[model samples]
Target chain A: MKKLLDIIVRIFRFIFFIFYYLKELVLSSLFIAYDIITPKDLMKPGIVEVPVDLKNDTAIIAFANLISMTPGSLSMDMNPEKTKIYIHAMYLHDKQEFVDKIKNELEKKIHQIFE
Target chain B: MIDWIAAFFLIAGSLFMLVAAIGVVKLSDVYMRMHAITKAASLGAILMLVAVSLLYVQWIVWIEALMVVVFVILTAPIASHMIAKAAHKTNMPKGPNYVMDELEGVDTDIPDKA
Candidate 1:
């Protein structure tokens, strides 16, 4: 049945995301402590606007939050229209590349599950 | 052997908490500090809970500890988001090293401080 296949696929994706997010969280937390432990030139901690396509409130909030727990990035605020989110990132090698990853990796997976 | 594993987790958890505490003091400004509190501290606490559950060696204790862990994982980020949002909205001071704050331009409703 198509419905059965959908449910099965969704469940697998759910498991995949849980592990993916957890792995990233633990690693990033270690990185944060490592940054503090060793004296390095601190990156300018500035906020960048991440353009978003997610409109559903729950998914949008989760998307914002998923980034926050990571080491160098924190979601500061969402725009009034939900079109963008402000993130305080420790580094920004290439903004467009970063945004593209968010869309391709995070937003797409989350959208499949919640939206 | 069980004790050894539990002790490792206990030590690990305590160390994370210690690092988090130090980070909170050493880190400047609110946004960075929030990172210390929620991420490091939460992980530390979760590890501690695991150690406690292991030390007690009881199913009920493990269940209860896991319940607490679940609650913590669910709430910590939400709490951090609230603080971050409020901090962003109210114009809290930023650290010296950070590059740019684009949010200042995006939020039109922020009243002129002068």
Candidate 2:
């Protein structure tokens, strides 16, 4: 009975995380479309390497995939050591802010879902 | 009310598709363009499928749309990831103003493929 409750809680958390991310994702994608559509010099595309704290392979892949799916970001490659993930961002204004989102928000949620 | 609802959805779906197409062309490079194509195209496809499913309101049609959404959600990321990796390996050029290559100096033993 305890195990069943635990499983239920995890599934609920996972679903909630998906919905939360989906809402943010859709809104941002819409905004990104505008940036692309404009004639203004609004985009600064760059490849950034973000250090990874999550050791699990599943978590790493999920994080990378989510980064790719998010507006204006694409996961390029993880180094041979898997210590850092290289990503291309349409707007490369702040590296620390993006990495913080990956570490604190995305990776934290992924850890909750998986382990 | 139903007519209005369906019309709204159809319009929304078409707008997304149009944006995706324009983005693919206007965006600078392969990876950036991939970001535009996969994200916009998949979202557009989902919205369009949902509008169609709502229109038909048939059991099989609804089920088929549900399946399509699931399939798209599952595969789009995988496709984007693989393509990015391949592009990286092939030394595909990024946009001119694009800055930084985090993978620049990292040595990798992964062999190039035929």
Candidate 3:
């Protein structure tokens, strides 16, 4: 019964993530489209290191890929130890805030689903 | 009505693709260009696939469209990462507007060009 409940919760979380990811995909695309349509140099590209607590390779790769697909962020590379990932962001105003947002929102959701 | 909706998605997808093309030409450097390609272009393609599936309304077509989307979402990021990594490792020229680089000295294999 406990296993069944766990499975049900996982399924619910997975469905929610799918909807969340779709919303992000469309929103990010529209934002980029707006940037591209205008004649402004509105980019502030920078690289930042984000630490991850993912236990396995598959989850790490998914996290990276999701970041790349999201707004203005790309996963450039990972360290040899796989503890940290390097990201190139198009618009980076606040470093610590960005890190905190990803940890709290994206990473936490991924952990709930995978871990 | 459904036909009109499908048409709208198709047109929107094509417009997004055009925007991606313009971005590739207008952006400052490779990194910025990739931001256009990986995000806008892939989303545009997915929208087009969705439009196509909507028009056909067959189970097989729906499955095929879903497969395409899955493949694209899986592969596009890895491909862009490879390019970005290679550019960084090879000391590719950065745009004039970059602010910070935290990856500097993080990798030992990057040839010391500076």
Candidate 4:
């Protein structure tokens, strides 16, 4: 019974993750569309270092891809130690806020799904 | 009514693709252009596929649409990541607004040829 319940929970979490990713995909595309249509120079591109907590290679790859697909951000490279990832953002108004948001939202959700 | 909804999605997807094209021309840097192409293009493709799946009643159409969406979503990030990494490796010039580069001087698998 416990094993069945665990499987059910995992499936539910996976479904939720897919919905969350879809939402992100739509919103981010809209945001980019708006940015492109406007004439103003609204972009402030920069590369910021995000510390990684997930150790598994599959998890890391998924996390990087999710980040890339999301709003204004792209995963560029990871350190040799695998402890940090370099992310390039088109509009990075605040570096610390960006790092914290990724950690709290994307990374946490990925951790739940993978682990 | 269903046709209207499908048309709306198709139009919206086309608009997104248009924006991506404009962005590629207007964006000042390689990284920013990659952002425009990868995210917007993939989402546009997915939306169109969704519209196709919605219009058709056949189960096979839905399955095919789902497969295409999966293929697009899976490949987009990997393609963007590879482009970004290559640009970084070759020391491609950044835009004027580029503020910070955390990856600078970090030795990875590829030696910085620039």
Candidate 5:
């Protein structure tokens, strides 16, 4: 029964991965398109650390990669001991909001996909 | 038509940038600040870069923009990881609002003192 459940979960995860990748591709393409047309120097890039709740390394790595692939940010560091991520961002406003965004949005998706 | 597109890109990018900056200022902890910097800033940059590419219509410029994107994609996470690790080693405090700590009590080995 446990093996059967594992198989089913794996299949579901595979399907989810496909969908996630597709979404990521579309979003990245759109971001690239947007990058091609605008003119302004409004970016205030900096590195900031994001605390992580998830314990798995694979999940953490995936989360970092996902953030990097997104438009305005890159995941620059991962402190394994601290369980935190350092990200270099071209834009930032409310740090707590950003943290919450990652925890609630990006990390949540990652946990669903990887867990 | 082109001008309008450029304007839109500029405005959108600026908005993203502004929001990212605000996040850095408003967030209470280092972890939260990192989140603001990575997501909003990356999106803002992509928007701004796209706008520039549209205006220039030059292959080299577009390629350069792509390179920047690539660099950002590659570096941001690595940096984040390093910083987080450093914080952990230094025993940085987690936010009070955090509810659960999955890493707690996972290992029982003691470190050898030099």
Candidate 6:
């Protein structure tokens, strides 16, 4: 019974990984395409340090990569001691809003994946 | 007509760049400075690239612009992570305004080879 349960969990994790990769692939491609075509300069990019709530290197690395892959932003630095992520964003309309976006959106997704 | 659009992109990109510089100067901490530089500067560069691509419309220019975008996207985060880890290991001071520290007590220091 234990062996069977382990296999089942493994299968579920594999499926989840596939789903995450697909999401990343689709989102990144679209970002690249839109960036190439858009004529208007919609980017109000800036770098901001985000305090990371997630623990573990895997979670942090995945979170950083996800941010980098997303449209209009890039992760430039991660302060592990401070648990902060420095992100360079192309569309920073408001500072607090940007922080909320990272914490609520991307970081949430990362927590789900890594934690 | 094309010139107008190109000029617009150029100006917008330059403005973003200026804002990024200001952010770097204005932000209180190292992490904040990194944030200001990366986001604003990347966008500014992208905008400039787009304007240039529109003006030239050459395959080579387009390719170069794409490369810049790709490189920035890939490396920016890695750089940030490295800096953050190093800072943490070195025990950099945080802003007094900082409320909570999740990384507190975490073993961020590197083990000596000796």
Instruction: Indicate the DockQ of the complex predicted as candidate 5.
Output: 0.09
Error of 5 at B94 (Å): 2.8
Which numbered prediction scores highest in lDDT against the true structure?
A: 4
- Chain B TM-scores of the candidates: 0.88, 0.88, 0.90, 0.92, 0.84, 0.88
Q: Looking at candidate 4, what is the lDDT of residue B101?
A: 91
Arranged by lDDT, best first: 4, 3, 1, 2, 6, 5
lDDT of 3: 0.88
Q: Model 5 over residues A44-77: C-alpha lDDT tens digits?
A: 4445667887777787777777776565565655
Q: What are the per-residue Cα lDDT tens digits for candidate 4 across B2-110?
A: 9999999999898889999999999988998999998899988988988998899899998889899998988899988888988898898888967899888777784
How far residue A106's Cα lies from its native spot in candidate 6, in Å, is 3.1
Evaluate candidate 5 and give its CAPRI docking class based on DockQ. Answer: incorrect
- Please, what are the lDDT tens digits per residue for candidate 2 over residues A1-115? 9999999999899799778656755765687678777888777777777877777887777777677766678777777677777777787788788777767877777778876
Question: For model 2, what is the error of residue B95's alpha carbon versus the real structure, in angstroms, after optimal superposition?
Answer: 1.5
Candidate no. 5 TM-score: 0.53
The fnat of each candidate, in order, is: 0.55, 0.59, 0.80, 0.79, 0.14, 0.14
Off by over 4 Å in 6: A1-62, A68-104, A107-115, B109-114
**DockQ preference between candidates 4 and 5, better one:** 4
Query: Cα miss at A58, model 1 (Å)?
Result: 2.5
lDDT of 3 by residue, B1-114 (tens): 989999999999999999999999999889889989988899899999989999998999999999999888889889999999999988888998788999887763545578
TM-score of structure candidate 2: 0.89
Q: How are the candidates ranked when ordered by TM-score, highest leading?
A: 4, 3, 1, 2, 6, 5
- Residue A55 lDDT in candidate 5: 77
Q: Report the lDDT tens digits of candidate 6 across residue range B32-93.
A: 55555545566677778889989998899899988997777556657765675566557777
TM-score for chain A as predicted in candidate 5:
0.79
Choose the strongest candidate by DockQ: 4
Clashing pairs in 2: none
Candidate 3 colliding pairs: none
**Alpha-carbon runs more than 4 Å astray in model 3:** B108-114
Model 1 clash tally, residue pairs: 4
